[model samples]
Target: MSDSQHHNEEEQAKIRTSRALAALTIAANAQISVEDACASVVDESGDEGLDAIGITLARGEIYVVQAKASSGSPSPTEVLKFNQGIRYLLDWDWDSLGGKTQKRRGEIEAASEDDVKVIAIFSHFGAQKTDEAATKLSDKLLSEVNSSGNILDFQYQGLRENHDNRNIASGLGLPDYDLVFERWITMNDYRSEIMGVVTGDQLARMVDSFNERLFDKNIRAVLKATDTNKILDATLERSPQDFWYYNNGITIVSNSISCARTSPRTADETFKLQGLSVVNGAQTCGALGRALRENAPLEDVRVTVRVMSKEGHSEDFTKKVTRYTNTQNQVTNREFVSLDPYQQELSESLLSEQIQYSFRTGQTLDYDEHAFAFDLEEATRALACLTGVDNATRAKREIGRMWSDITANPYRELFPRNLHPATMYNAVQFRRVFDERYMASSRWMDTRSGGIIKNSTYMACALFMQKARNEKLDFSDIDLDVESWVSSKGADIYGLAAIVVELHENENPGGFPMSFFKNRQKIEEFARKVRTRFQETGS
Candidate 1:
């Protein structure tokens, strides 16, 4: 060994150290571990393949982030690689057959079923252009999640010029993360829509029940915008036997808008006409008092004085006066709380002017869609009359939730056995489908129907489908492998089942000889037994 040679080797080592340091610096800046970031690799062997590195642990259903590192910018490409590696690590089953890979996290090897999850952390990997690979992996994920007809979603910041991955996910019916976020916003909107239909305790109980039923289920059950309208509607309709799973962990009810309004009026008031001031007489010279145009009918008009007579007392007054009435008096008949000649006439003129404008526009009630929107409108009007909190968004949301719950979620836990098994299944399916769809779809309010209801539209659609399937009952040419045909045919099956059950129930409501919906007790027992059976079967 020559000294010169030793110096050359030292120089090479310094370069390697600098490159590694740069990688770490980049990862930190990107807010990802070096393991999550990927440095391009020139070769599979030696340090050329080195990039980021980290370790991870699985917890229940979500992946627990642990020691991880990224080696470059957190670009979309980097995200793809990181996610791919994570998926690979999660799916790996070491005990199955092949020898364990070097990246295997030892702790997971002995974990039981409950402890396992499709989650992982990474330490190191390199960027490799594999559009084909990315496409295949994303497709598989979408298929797996959507096959069961569950809502799927994803979220990311901003927009992209080209997002093949997102497009593919959408085409396969998997919602991007953004969809979930949007649904959450929509859920808030829906809460506002239904908060006016029920009482406070009832709403609270509904939420409590929903949360309780979902507590034992996975977090996946907590999708946004759950259509509590069905349950709420059922309650409102006075159908007592249709409440579904009680403990879903989410808020079940909200305060009604009407319940939240504040009334603050002592009684009716009257105002006598007051002489008009001539402060701006020059401005109105041409039309001192030309025939006044009457817009609104003289009714329930209010007048108020802000100033005080050396004392702090409000000078507000009301009047009921007619406009352009042709009568024997040749004078307009008016009623007022008090006639302080100075205040009464002026107030009446002003009131008349405002009413004229109101009448021209034909201003009336603003229509809403809830079954009981009138009640809320009445409340709003009453509250407005009192004068305090005028517009209450929270109150409305609370009220809407309450009303929706009462209308939906029937309490028929023990459906009579006279109802056929298929009918029972359809009912169960409707509840499930309604819940799932309601959770996913935007709130559909029908003011004409009453007030703002939740997605009873979905249930209505379900019913329609149920009927359609029964009518178009033909599955002789079905081929399960052909995706399009399979889906098309499945719709028919689901619909037919619903209709049959409905007909059976209608035909024999008085203790029909059916196994599933025979009577309250039998149906209840069957539900318990069936649920237990499903659990045993690992469904």
Candidate 2:
């Protein structure tokens, strides 16, 4: 044969070999549904039933397998049609195993190596249809297969080929048994199962369970589209040493316009420019203060920072500024060194410094869940202990408190002075914000209703802010007006309101409208009421 002809034949042979190997690999090792023709056994009670094995992923993918023996089974063409239906109903993805896309077939290649994730799959089922009607019904299931990347359907099919003769085609396997199973799983749905497989809460914490790889893809895509590198460097950083962190200090500053200032400044004015800086600075300091709080014992809390520069002038300048995270006061006195003296000559244009602050405990970022938990622990603990608590009730109460807290001040620690007004946060402002859900609880609801409750205390604070603004009023009468306004909203909104009102009212008898305070007791009580009422009652 000519070389070209021989090469062409070899290519075709490779293709056939590849296909055959794939088919055999799947048939031998893959979990499959087997059908046996003999009647299934019945219990002494004389009930008619067929038992089969199946596999499932959490709301994700499902594979059902059944085996049957038929001496005169339908043709392979007929079986292929039936297999299509099973793939559709169960929503299984076909295996391409790293191949180029097939436009006509509408097949998608696997995403990236890191991107594909295994969903929790239960097992494979095998069973024989109970009757001839059932057998024909299986034939009707052939219409559902598709090649869309977005949908999961059809993995592989297997039939018993070598076992018997006169069985015609003898055995048939369709992409993992279709048979109209119930549900498909999403990324979030398989979280628990993923947790089981990956074996680390820390890993799960860093990466989104199912969508982690997807998220990383999106982040890169966004950075690329925005040309964000030119705008700001280092999108992800494990430490302050990242290039973005040390950009010519000029580039590191936020580019947005600062707010305007007025005398006897309001938050609107203070949060604009100078006030925001002060607020952030103070918040950073506050994080340090909370870490030092007496109740929470912390160890290995250390802070060391220094700036190195090529020029002596830069060395002097570095000393003028304060450096610290929210650690202890003892950290303030750490040596602010000019490491340049210890090193060889430095250039005036270049500078570097290591500022290390470590807190073995009590280092809480303003929005960190730990910080929030610390603030809410007192109340949550007590409430959770109640005897009659239920799941729905617990969900509602906890959801309400969580939303209330998060929405009330997402950036509070970061920008305390210019805290975004609650009303301005359309995402979290509605009464329904409190009705949000955690990962698991959402499945229980048919409609998934009613989680957040803006108790009277919140209403009081909101109402106080609203009325004072509307009436061209001063906060001088905050206690009286807040109480009255909260009372008007309803007893429930007012219930927690009264407690805070009385507490604050006593702290400042002369009437102080201190906007921020940690009322842990109240926050937990609210969380408990929500957890008990919603979770226990399944409301």
- The prediction achieving the highest TM-score against the true structure is 2
Give the candidate number with the greatest lDDT.
1
lDDT of 1: 0.25
How close to the true structure is residue 533 of candidate 1, measured as C-alpha lDDT? 40
| Per-prediction TM-score to the true structure, in the order listed | 0.18, 0.20
Give the lDDT of residue 48 in candidate 1: 18
lDDT of 1 at 82: 43
- Model 1 residue 288 lDDT score: 10
Shift of residue 285 alpha carbon in model 1, Å: 84
- Writing each residue's lDDT as its tens digit, candidate 1 over 248-325 gives 112211111111114311222111112111111111111111101112121111111111011122222101001111
lDDT (0 to 1) per candidate? 0.25, 0.23
Ten-residue segment with the worst summed lDDT in candidate 1? 174-183
Query: Model 1: how far is 458 from its true place, Å?
Result: 13
Give the TM-score (vs. native) of candidate 2. 0.20
